[model samples]
Target: MDSISQLPDALLLGVLSLLPAKDVVATMILSKRWQFLWMFVPKLIYDDNYQNIEFERLSRFVYRSLLLHEAPVIETLHFIIRPKSNVVDIGVWTRTAVKRCVRELIIEMDCSSSSTAPVMLPRSLYSGCSILVKLKLKKVVLVDVTSPFSFPSLKELSLKSVKYPDEEFVQSLLSNCPVLESLVVKQCPNDNATIFTVKNSSLKSLVLENQDLRYNDIGAGYVIDAPSLEKFKIRDLHEDRFCVIENEMPNIVEADIDVAYGHPGKILSSITSVKHLTLCITSSKDAYPVGLAFCSLVYLEIWTLDTEWSNDLNLLMCVLRDSPNLRALKLEQLDCDGDRSCWMEPSSAPECVIWSLETLELVDYEGAEEEKKVIAFILRNANCLKKATISTESTDPNKRLEMLKELELFPRRSPNCQLAFYYSP
Candidate 1:
């Protein structure tokens, strides 16, 4: 303690910055050197769950700490409010943070207990925070602002289970961020946006998750028009939910498409430029464009559902036929239940399997006859394969040894290909 106390004030403050607000303030009682060090910590995180303080006391501490904080710039201000907390006090705290020139601000309300309504953020936060770089709000209500508003320097924005005023507000808010780079929106029921549209030119990554189970039949959908997107992810397993890409993402390098929609032809066609793709679908028929070619694809991951293995294999073959440059392939089955589906080999091998594929992984392998046949087909066709790994779902030693011996006996087209096996359980 004596040696640490002799360190420079800057070093001490740096250490304090990593601690939460409660702990930072508690350090004042250590010694005279630490009495005022907490005041200069640039980042403050106030989470009610950390301490057992009453709501009123927590509010007072936050108000007092912000008042005494002497930092020149608040690099980050994070607040996690509990259910049934006072909204008026939260507004004041946010306004104070905005006044302190906070670069990154996060306000998340606990919505687990449905006893309180979503907190409506202060209007000053909308118009005053011009220099904010990143803003994330969860389980809050965004009120409409009649005055001019824009986050000129904001780059990353995430809205998780947030309530917007209307659909126009959603589009307007996104359009106002001129230089935004990343956006994540997790939708909930009655998010006030029937058709969520994102039309940003500067965005490089986008993630959209639709959890609105009650509104699938109402024609609710998404429209994305981000031309510069490099990474894209969408997960909508609900039935009948649709997505429309306004333009092809020529710059996309990675993509994850997990959907149960009947027609995904348009979605698959727009991401052909992707180099790494993760695909999950419930049906195989018309899941993607008939002739769509992923010319730049180097890595592919396919997630198999509990449905028929034939449908999954058909989709796998279709994708492999188009991805001629794919070097690595991973197949993961979600479960090991139900009767094994019969495996029927295609008349011809995919170009990727014959030439480009180097690595193959089979996850949750049940060692059934159908699985063995599928593995044998790949081993026989993949001439350039270097390594193949099979992770079995069974933990029985006899079954595992039997499976390993059977796999080892399969003929490998590539003389150098190494076969590895393991029990996952």
Candidate 2:
């Protein structure tokens, strides 16, 4: 009884459709022609870790494995259940995987530390799947569905820890997902999606995470226009919310602005055609007004959470004097305000440190003396610099050799500049 069990039967159901639907129903005890061959296995995954089971014996083993799944065409149906799972057995396993035509439907019914009751997303999966192309939901609950919501070949959507019944029912479920294109909204500790309007034009990658504005109610906000966006991310949106930008996104390149406590409002001049920007804030009102022209900036990242090092080095010298084609710079100092005092250099210099800066990175470096005078004013004015990396938070040994001999006596003006240091624990 070998010869690889006499392969065939569509090459053993394509190797049991790469297992895991309880290991392809435990190969039905490998006999009787592998018994019903896991009913033509076609990718049916049920990730169960239901914390100490017994939900009626896991809903009678998912109703006898969907009555021995016959698989006509269900490309992928990943259901992650737990936390009191059993909304009528997830509406009879999402109406039997949308009547066997599912094409990527990932459901995460986490119930968030259950008290059960919160699993209503089975209106025949919005009109019996018109070939769904990817939908991901978490913590489930999206009622108020009226019909006419046709997905028409959806294209990647993710709503984490969801619970919508308003905000125009999440803007009529994102204007009926007509050709969606990668979207992710993560908020849930019983999140109630407060006014998150995204005007998708076949969207192009967006991610908005965590919204808990002390239970917003007085002028809540969040809005985007998505003129065919090109990757955007926003986090926290600290308090006085009212962030709206229902237009202007001339095909953004890449942005990851984090607003944890203040100012990030005008959507940072509507992502002036961003080119890899990441600015985390705590205040310094997100300085960016050197006539706001990041004309397709080139990689700049600065994060500051517990400020005061002269307001994150004056917001990193006003985002390197407004990113004039910035080449590469990453500076991060989340917290450590003993205020050792120093940063008083920028009285000019900074057109990307005198001509398209070239790669510099400092993270959590606390040589203080204002981070060794901002790394000796970027190795004495970048001049098309070529690689400077410091990583210290000084675990003293004479303070990391007095910050590598005070930044190697800073003079450098890039004749192929190069310097390095480490020690971040």
**Which model scores highest in lDDT?**
1
On the 0 to 100 scale, the lDDT of residue 93 in model 2 is 82
Q: Report lDDT per candidate.
A: 0.88, 0.77
- Tens digit of lDDT per residue, candidate 1, span 1-425? 87999999889888887888999999999999889989999889998777667889899999999999999888899999986789999989999999998999999987767664788898888888888999999988898989978999999999998899999999889999999999999988877987999999999999999856665746888999999999999999776879999997999999999888888768999999999999888776657578899999999999967467776777888899999999999998844457756667899999999999999999998776677777899999999999999998786899889888889999999999999898887
Off by over 4 Å in 2: 1-82, 89-108, 111-120, 124-136, 139-148, 151-182, 185-200, 204-227, 232-250, 253-273, 278-295, 298-324, 331-353, 356-361, 364-391, 412-425
Per residue, candidate 2 scores C-alpha lDDT tens digits across 208-312 of 886655555545667887788899988875566566887898888998988754556477788888899988877665444546778678898888764466767
Collision pairs in model 1: none
Give per-model TM-scores.
0.96, 0.33
**C-alpha-based local distance difference test score of model 1:** 0.88
How many angstroms is residue 87 displaced in model 2 relative to the true structure, after the best TM-score fit?
Answer: 1.9
Error of 1 at 57 (Å): 0.3
Per-structure clash totals for the candidates: 0, 0
